[model samples]
Structures are given as structure tokens and as C-alpha cells.
Target: MMTILIPATVAAVLGGFALRIWYRRWKQQRIEANRKVEAPNSYYSSRGVRQQEDRERWHSIKVGTLHPLNREEVLRLLDVVDEDGVSSLSRKDRLFLDNMTLPRMGV
Candidate 1:
């Protein structure tokens, strides 16, 4: 009787554990099934607007058709950097500095 009772108790505990695991997996699957997936381009829809504009401007500058910034423009940019620190500049401002200081790749 004692031997039979021990085995029965062990089997009951294991059965309960297995049932619990199955219920949790079922719950997770239901949650996943009900979840709404975002469109691939949705992430970029509103994000990076400024970065995109900066890239377009940089590309235009790199085309080399635009004349180099005049002396006054350069001075104004420098003064802003000097007074407020470099981080105060906008993306366009920073890109202008990049274009002026960095050597042209081919020429």
C-alpha cells in the first residue's frame, strides 16, 4: 500500500506540472495570434525625417554644382559654433562644416 501511494503521488505532481506548462503555452499562442503586426515601412514613416533631409542636402552639395559657401556665411557659422559650442548647430549647419573642412574625395 505504501509503495503504491508513493508512485501515485509522484505521478499526480508530474501530471499537474505538465498541465501547467501546456496552459501557459496555449495562453502565449493566443496572445501572439491576437497581436497586430506593424507594416515594414511604418517604423520609418515618421522617424528620420530630419536625417533624410540632411542626406538630400549633402548629396546636393556633393554633386559639386553648388558654389562653395561665401566668406560671410562661413564667418557666421564659425561665430555660432564659437559662442554656443558645436552642438548648438542644426544638421544643415553641421553638414556645412563637414563639407568645408573635409577634403573632397576625388578632387
Candidate 2:
């Protein structure tokens, strides 16, 4: 009984360690692959995201009206910054984000 318990415990510990290492390596590989895929796409993320669902409602609004970035767009932009770093933003996207940082009126 003692020998069985000891081996079982050792196996569990070793298995946990092996799983941890494999998971770390797997995560690194997946992240590298995603970065490679997204490298070219990082630019398109800022300006060309087509909000088809939202656009249906916005169609009534005049084209020239200054539309604020909606909640999801803000979150996606933040995710882009988190993933790719600040330098990833185009000048226009950077300025747009900069303007977003300003204090709002009557809040």
C-alpha cells in the first residue's frame, strides 16, 4: 500500500510538471503564430473594421456627423494596443485615440 501511494504521488507531481512545461511551450507557439498572422493585419484593424450591425442603425445619421467610438470599438482598439503596442497605430488612429482621451462634456 505504501509503495503504491508513493509512486502514485510521484507520478502525479511529475505529470503536473510536464503538463506545465508543455502548456507554456504550446502557448508560446500559439502566440508566435498569431503574431505572424496579425503582423500584416495590425494596420487594417484600426480603420477598416466594418460594423455592419451597427451601421444599419447609423445609416440614418448624416455622413458628416462626428460619431463617437462605441464601447466595443473602444475595447477592440485597446486590445490592439495591448497585443501590438502603441507604435502599431497609424497616425490617424493615434490622433483619433488621442482625441478620445480628452475630458468629455457634462459628464
Candidate 3:
């Protein structure tokens, strides 16, 4: 009886220790995951800078005004559309295309 009790008691203590270690590790992993989720990626940070510059350029242009682009400028935009889908164009680029096409549409 004494021998059986001693081994069972030892196993319970060891199991408690094991559970404690596993719980601590799980908690640490959760913290690390949260940090990763919260962290700002450098790629996105740089993209944001580019986007801000585009916004500033967009603001400088007058609305409801026809701003004609040079041949190279027009080709550059077309090349961008061909390389990357139309969805890749910024709001200002889309507006430029819209204004340019409006006259051709006979509207």
C-alpha cells in the first residue's frame, strides 16, 4: 500500500509540474502571436509614404479641369495598366483617364 501510494503521489506531482510548464508555454506563445499581429510591417510603412505623396499630388490638381499629359506621361500610365491591372492605378490616375475619355465618348 505504501509503495503504491508513493508512486501515485509522485506521478500527480510530476503531472502538475508538466501542466504548469505547458500552460506557461502556451501563454508565452499567445503573447508572441499578439505582438506579431500588432507589429507594423516595413513594406506597408513605405507603401504608406508613397500613398501620401500621391495624395499630395492629387490635391494639387484642380478639379473639373482638363490637365493634358504629355505623350510620354500618357504612355507611362498605359504601360502601368498593361503591366499591373487597372486596379493598380491610384484614384488620381483613374480620374485622369476618366477626364481624358469623357470627351472621346461624345458626352
Candidate 4:
């Protein structure tokens, strides 16, 4: 009876340890697979194109060729100032124009 009990107890303990190791490996593999699935669609891929477009748009606005304060424009000059910065306006007159027209446009 004692011999049988000792062998059975040892076997149970070894089986428990094996199960724990297997569970850990399975969990690690699942996490890695999830990361692979989710990582590619993130903003990392389009960052360069988005940045380039933003730079060109800002340059056009700064040079006055792309004035947002124009009569049929969707965004006002103040919207540009708020999204970009006041330093992008280049002159006090442009800043005053933005301040004046933005309120009239209900921006």
C-alpha cells in the first residue's frame, strides 16, 4: 500500500508541472499571433505620406495661395491659425485678417 501511494503521488505532481509548462507555452504563442495580426494596420505605414501632404498644404497656406479665408472656403483663416500656429501667418496684417474674418464666418 505505501509503495503504491508514493508512486501515485509522484506521478500526479509531475503531471501538474507538465500541464503548467504547456499552458504557459500556449499562452505565449497566442499573444505573439495576436501582435502579428494587429501591428501591420497601425498608423506606422501611412505616416510618411500624411506628413508630406501636411507639409505641402501648410506651405501653400503660408504663401497665401491657399487662403482659407476666401469667400467659398470651408475653413477660415483662424481655423488654419488654430490648427497650425500664429507663426505660420508671417505678418500682423494676416493675423488681424484671421481675427476679423473668423468671427464673421462663425468660426
- Number of the top-ranking candidate, with lDDT as the measure: 1
Q: How close is every model to the real structure, measured as TM-score? A: 0.37, 0.35, 0.34, 0.45
Candidate 1 per-residue lDDT over residues 1-107, each given as its tens digit: 99999999999999999999999999999999999988774534443564444334433433343345544565676677657655578978876656755453333
Residue 65 CA displacement from its true place in model 4, Å: 6.5
Query: What TM-score would candidate 3 get against the native?
Result: 0.34
Candidate 3's residue-wise lDDT over 1-107, tens digit each? 99999999999999999999999999999998888453563334466575454444433434345434444455566677667756689888767755544232112
- Off-target runs (Cα >4 Å) in candidate 2 are 36-107
Clashing pairs in 1: none
The better-scoring model by lDDT among 1 and 2 is 1
Residue-pair clashes per candidate: 0, 0, 0, 0
In model 4, what is the error at residue 87, expressed in angstroms?
12
lDDT of each: 0.64, 0.56, 0.62, 0.56
lDDT of 3: 0.62
Per-residue accuracy of model 2 over 1-107 as CA lDDT, tens digit each? 99899999999999999999999999999998888444663434332242332223223333333454554455556567667766565767655554545433222
Candidate achieving the largest TM-score: 4
lDDT of 4 by residue, 1-107 (tens): 99999999999999999999999999999998888454654545465564454434433444344455452242454466568764465565364554433232112
Q: Which pairs, if any, clash in model 2? A: none
